[model samples]
Target: MRSSVDIETIFATMAVGLVAVASILMTSAPLGAQDGSRSRPVSLGADDRAAALESVQFALAELGDGASYVWHRGHGKLSGVVQPTQSFVDGKGRVCRHVVVLLSAGEKSRKTEAIACRLENGVWRFDS
Candidate 1:
């Protein structure tokens, strides 16, 4: 037989737990689905472009409207359309690559575009 105070404590604790779980799920679930895969640009038609653009779109969503990106069409080592990656600029303005995917020779003919951004003053802004 729990008292009223005891019941209130339980409900409060449960509500906090639910909020924590929901926050984690909302943040982590969309990016990491074990089944569905996103596409990357490669040598192909419109479908291939759409597939390739999925990653770009995901990255751009909720991003600052002023963010900028450039077209990088060249040789890469990425195996899949999307690969784990990071980008940063050194003090001298040189860009750094953390992870990259090498593409396949078969997909070399695919045409694509990319948008990249930089963090400025704790907010993301477009880069040229």
Candidate 2:
């Protein structure tokens, strides 16, 4: 048998706990999943370019096949998906990543593949 004040306190504690749980869930959810939006055209701003470059470097270092990152293509003015398809060590002992990227603009999309090698300076350069 709880008093009115005790019941109120229990309800308040439960509410707080529920709020904390909701916040945790929201923060842990993926950005795209939370918004329920498909991949859209991304503008290649300075920050976006830096993030895309970093993602590429991370993918190369991890060397995980099918691992992907989002990028923005300036020439096509579209959003792009960059994924590592394969990786190998070259004769010069440089780690190379073969990547495939899909660039999408409006209703059109283009797919391109390239090989990028990790340099001594820790930078990944596309090998043409």
Candidate 3:
């Protein structure tokens, strides 16, 4: 018994609802999953994480700009390259370096950047 206008309005509302649902799904989905181009980096186990962090710290502390060190050579499940991209002295005279870490596990990989500052005690630590 619905009029023609009522039917049209119902269809319009349903269309809008569907569009909203689709928008939500599109935004919530991961970029790699949607595009099939990049896979998200898988998490490393505790030992692997520790090894990677140690290598990253060494690169940040010792490597000059544009120098890179490859890590996880023969033992760990995680492998990566750590490079110091830039270095500068902070206002407090602490040497700070910008480091890039390319980490990979199996077929997944991720690149991360961090700034580490040398402390007064001569230890380099990543900024929190």
| Best by the TM-score measure | 3
TM-score of 3: 0.61
Question: Looking at candidate 3, what is the lDDT of residue 87?
Answer: 93
Q: Tens digits of per-residue lDDT for model 3 on 14-83?
A: 3222112112112233223434666663333345545655776678777889999997636544577878
Regarding TM-score, does 1 or 3 come out ahead?
3
Residue 65 error for model 2, in Å? 1.6
Clashes of 2: 0
Model 3 segments more than 4 A misplaced: 1-43, 73-76
**1-128: candidate 2 lDDT, tens digit per residue:** 11112222322343222112112112223123334567543333443334445655666667588778776545545465768888889888998877765534445444546677778988676664
**In model 3, where is the ten-residue run with the lowest total lDDT?**
16-25
Candidate 1 displacement at residue 103 in angstroms:
3.5
CA-lDDT, candidates in order: 0.30, 0.51, 0.55
lDDT of 1 by residue, 1-128 (tens): 11112222322343222112112212222212323545332233333333333434343433233343332323342223323245666565644222221223222322222223434433222232
Clashes of each: 15, 0, 0
Q: Distance from true position, residue 41, model 2, in Å?
A: 12
The clash number for model 3 is 0
Instruction: Indicate which candidate wins on lDDT.
Output: 3
What RMSD value applies to candidate 3?
17.4
